[model samples]
Target: MTDPSRRRVVVGVDGSTESRTALRLAVDEARYRNCLLQIVRSVEMYEENPESEELDSAVAFVRDDLGFTEVSGLVTSGFPAMALLEQAADAELVVVGSRPRSAIASVVLGSVGSAVATHAPCPVIVARTSGERATPGARVVVGVDGSDVSERAVDFAFGEASHRGTGLVAVHCWQVDHPAAARWDAEAFATRRNEHLRWMSESLAGFQDKYPEVQVTTSLLEGRPAVLLTELSRGAGLVVVGSRGRGGLVGMLLGSVSQSLLHHAYCSIAVVRPVVPSS
Candidate 1:
C-alpha cells in the first residue's frame, strides 16, 4: 500500500493499447521518482465497465512481473477525465495516452489526453511508445518560449533528464512570418540565431544548478516551433512542451502548436501546464 501523504504518479488505464503504453511509462516514472503509482480505471454510468480482473492483473504485473513495489490500483465510477482530474489534484504528475487516430478522428473525438493536460492542477504527460527515440544517447527535449508555463516545462524537462541520466536539448524556433515581405540577410540571420541561443541558455539558468549532472544543449532553429519540435522528437526520448491553463471549451480545443506536436511528434509528448495557486 502506498502512503497517502506521498505525491504519486497517477495514470488512467482502460485496457486499451494506449492506456497500456501509458501504464508502462508510468511505472518507469514511479520507479525513478521514488514515489507511488496510482493506476485508475473509471466506469462511467450506464457504460460497460472494465473488468476488475484487468486492473488486478495490471497491478500484479507491476508488483510481480515488473517488481515495482510502490504501486496500487483503483476502479471507480464517473467520467474518466473527471475521475482522473480529481485524483490528480495533488499528484506529482498525471499521465494519459493519446489515441492513435487519423486527422479527422482527432477532431471528432476530443482527446482525454488533451483534456487532462489542460485542466489538471499539475503537469501532464501524454505518453506514447516510440522506439526511434529510445536510443542510448536519447535526450529529453523541451520547447522553450520564455513563457511562465514554458519555464515550468523547463523545470519538468530538467527533472526528467536527471531521472533518466540523460542529456537535455532546449529547442526554440523563430521564423519570419512571410518570406516575401522581409529581405533575407545572412548576417542578420546569424545574429538572430545567436540571440535565441542566449535566450535559451537564460531559460535554463535556474534549473542547471539543480540538475548539474544533466548535459544540456540548445537548438535555435529557423522554422515553425511546432514543426521543428516534431522533427526533433524523432531523435529524443521525450518531447516536452507547455500549454496554458484555460477552462471550458477553449481548454478542450488544444492550441495550434501543441495540437500539431501532439499529433505528429515521434516520441512521447509531455504537455505541461504551470501550477496555479488554489487561493
Candidate 2:
C-alpha cells in the first residue's frame, strides 16, 4: 500500500487546452486535499520517448509559474489511460479533462478520459462544465436513490460539501405511471408523492446528522431522473453521482440515463467509485 502521508492527486496532461484545464484543477485539488499533485503525460512506446520538451516545459511551468513546487510530472511509454491508471493505483483522486460535448461521449467511444474514470482506483472528476470553469462557492449536487451505491455517493457528497463549505443538493427522482396511462385522484397522487418524499428524506437522514453543517436540499421530483438532475444542477460547481443507481438519476456512468446529464449538465461531474482499501 502507498504511504498515507504521500497521498497524491493525479492528472493527465498532454499540453492540450483540455489537459491544461485538468492540470489547473488538479493543482487546486491537491492544495485543497493537502497532498501532492502528479501530472502524467503519455507517449507510445514505439515513439522517441526520451527528452520531451513539452513535458519538461509544462512541468517547469506548473512548478515555477504556478507556484506549486509540490507537483511532479511523469512521462510514460503507453496510452494515456494506462498511464493514468498506473499512477492512480494509490492516488486519492484522478482528474481528466474534456469538453462538455465530448466528456461522456469520449467515454462511450472508449476515450482515455472515460477509460480512466471507469477504472481508476480512486474517484475521477471530468472537468467539463457548460460554463468556462467551476466556481468555488457553487453548490455540490448529488444524485441519490437509496441504494448501496447511492449511499456511497451520499457519503462522498457529504464529505465534499463539508470540506467545500457549500450546500448540497440531493435529488431523488421517480415517475408514477404516465399521465395518459393512469388517472389518479388528487389525494392519491399526493399520497404517493409524500411516500416517495419521506423515503428520500430517510435515505439522507444519516448523512444529514453526520454533516450537520452542510445545508442540504432534497429534491424529490416526479420526472426523468437525468432531466431533473441536470436542471437542478445548472449552476453547480460539481455534480457528483454514483457509478450506478437504484433506478435514479444515474443508472450507469456509461448508460443512457447518465449520458443525458453527461450531455447537458453545465458543471463539472465527479464519478465516485468504491473507495480503494489500503492493504
Candidate 3:
C-alpha cells in the first residue's frame, strides 16, 4: 500500500502533442505538491526500438524544461493501459494525455486514461489537448448521484480542492420521464425539482463540513447527467465523476456517466472508482 504521507505523481508519455501537454501539467502539479515525479513510457510488442529512443528524448526534454531535479523515468514493454495501471498502484495521482485521434476512431476512456481510471488504486487525471487553460480561481466540480461510488468521487474532489486551495462545486442532475402526449406540468415539476435540490444539498453537507476551508457550491439541474456535467466542465479547472454507480451490473467495467464525460467533457476529468467489494 502507498503511504498517504508520501507524495508521488505518475504521468504517462507517448510522444504525442497531447502527451507533451500532459508532461508539462504533471511537472507543474508535482512542483505544486512538492512530490516526486515518475515518467512512465510503455512500448507495445509491435513497436520498434525507435519508440524507446523517442521516449528517452522526451524524458530529457521534460526534465530540462520543468527543472525538476527529483524525477524518475521508466521504460516498460507491455500493453499501454495495463502497464500504466500497474504503475499507479503506489501513486497519489496518475496523469495521462487525451488520445490524439478523432473521438470516433479513438478509444474513449478505453485506452490508457479510461483503463487506469477504472482500475487504478488512486485518482486518475485525463488531460485534454484542446489547449484549454485553467483559470487561476477555477473550481473543481464533482457530480453526485447518491451512490457509494459518487461518495468516493466526492472524497477525491474535496481532497483535491483542499490540496490545490481551490473551490469545489457539487452538481446533481435529475430527469423526469413523461409520456409523449403528456402535457407539461410546470407547478408540479417545480415542486419536485425543489425537493431534489434539497436532497442534493443535504447529501453534500458532509463534504462541505469536512473541508470547511474550501468553498463549496451545490447545483441541481434538470437534464441528462452527462450533458449537465459537460456543460459545467466548461468553466472548471477539473471535473470529477465516479466510475461505477447504482446502475446495471455492478461487476461491469465502466459506468455510463464516466464513459460519456470522458469523451465529451472539455476540461481535465478525474474518474474515481470505488474499492471492489470483497466476495
Candidate number with greatest lDDT: 3
For model 2, the stretches where C-alpha displacement exceeds 4 angstroms are 1-5, 45-51, 102-110, 132-136, 177-183, 247-253, 275-279
Cα lDDT of candidate 3 equals: 0.79
Q: Would you give me the overall lDDT of model 2?
A: 0.76
User: lDDT of all predictions, in order shown?
Assistant: 0.78, 0.76, 0.79
lDDT (Cα, tens digit) per residue for candidate 3, span 1-279: 324466788999988878888888788778767888888888876366787786777778877876776777778888988888887877878899885324462364357787777678777888876545668767999998989889999988998788778999899887776623223677777777788889887887887889899988888887888888988888678899888767735446778788787888878888887776668
TM-score of 2: 0.83
lDDT per residue for candidate 2 within 55-101, as digits (tens), equals 88778888887888887767888788998999888898999887654
Q: Estimate each model's TM-score.
A: 0.87, 0.83, 0.83
Better TM-score candidate (1, 2):
1
Q: State the RMSD for candidate 1.
A: 3.3
Model 3 TM-score on a 0 to 1 scale:
0.83
Residue 64's lDDT within candidate 1 is: 89
